[model samples]
Target chain A: AQTIHQWPVAEIKAVGSPLSLGCTIKGKSSPNLYWYWQATGGTLQQLFYSITVGQVESVVQLNLSASRPKDDQFILSTEKLLLSHSGFYLCAWSLTHSQNTLYFGAGTRLSVL
Target chain B: GDQVEQSPSALSLHEGTGSALRCNFTTTMRAVQWFQQNSRGSLINLFYLASGTKENGRLKSTFNSKESYSTLHIRDAQLEDSGTYFCAAINTGNYKYVFGAGTRLKVIA
Candidate 1:
């Protein structure tokens, strides 16, 4: 079975501080990875998606960036955190272009003070 | 442009009762996937339909590509079914999935 793991389940940071969240996929290689954000009582918004290493596409840019340094590792980072950036971040993976089903990670809750 | 729109933004049902959730797409979709976001905020994939209907236990889903719509029917609802339901569509041109706002369902015992 495949599993997606995300670190720092929850975080509270001050405005203007940097932010970094990590996600790792197990039991799958070269999977398509995605990053999503959901506000309090709101819908999920696609932030970024990567098809392979060193290639990431931004869907709804909020000045945030994504990186896939390894086959099963994806990272979401920002230099300056904003209050608007506070939300639930989710990492998902799909079986390349052959599969449309997305398996999501546990997610990280970030709150900017 | 909103590619996908889900009906019944919120719903409340009694245990054993049933209801249907619908999603309409503005463009032709290659496939549609239904998911349930639990209280803990983890999304569980319920059904992934490319063209036809599929059933599992008390949940069933149907996708019509020509009509550009999909439906999910929940029979004999239970308290554990309470959560937010989301429908995402895969676009043929790019294979990028666009998700709906979601339908919040609360089943009370």
Candidate 2:
């Protein structure tokens, strides 16, 4: 079975602080990775997606960026955090681009103050 | 821009009762997926349909690409069924997903 793991289940950071969130997929190789953000009680917004290592696509520009360092590892980071950046961050994976049944991780809850 | 309009932004059902959640797309989509965001903030995949309908346990879902809409029906609701439900449709051109606002469901005893 495939499993997705996200780091730092929850975090509270001050504005202007650097932030880094990580996600890893186990038992699946070459899976499509995606980053999603959701505000409190709001719909999810796709942030970025990567089909392969070292290449990422940005869906919405929120001053955040993502990188795929390894086949199964994805990282989301920013030089500085903003108060509006606080929300839920989810990591998801799919078997392939055609098979888009996404499986999400537990997610990271961020609070920027 | 593609859009998904979900109906009944909120719903309440007594145990054993049932209800249906619907999503209407503004543009034709290639496929649709349904999810449940639980209290702990984990999104559980309920269904992924390219067309037709599918059922599992007490949950059933249908997606019609030609009509540009989808629906999820939950029967015999239980306490664990209470959560926020979302419908997301994939764009045929880019395969990027457009999500609905969501339907918050509460099951009361």
Q: Pick the candidate with the highest lDDT.
A: 2
Clashing residue pairs in candidate 2 (N, C-alpha, C atoms within 3 angstroms): none
> Per-residue lDDT for A1-113 in model 2, tens only?
99999998999999999999999999999999999999999999999999999999999999999999999999999999999999999999987757689899999999999
| Candidate 1 segments exceeding 4 Å error | none
What are the candidates' individual DockQ scores?
Answer: 0.74, 0.84
Which candidate number maximizes DockQ? 2
Candidate 1 backbone collisions, by pair: none
Please give the RMSD of candidate 1 to the true structure: 0.9
* Model 2, runs deviating above 4 Å: none
Ten-residue stretch with the least lDDT total in model 2 chain A: A94-103
Q: What is the Cα root-mean-square deviation between model 2 and the actual structure?
A: 0.8
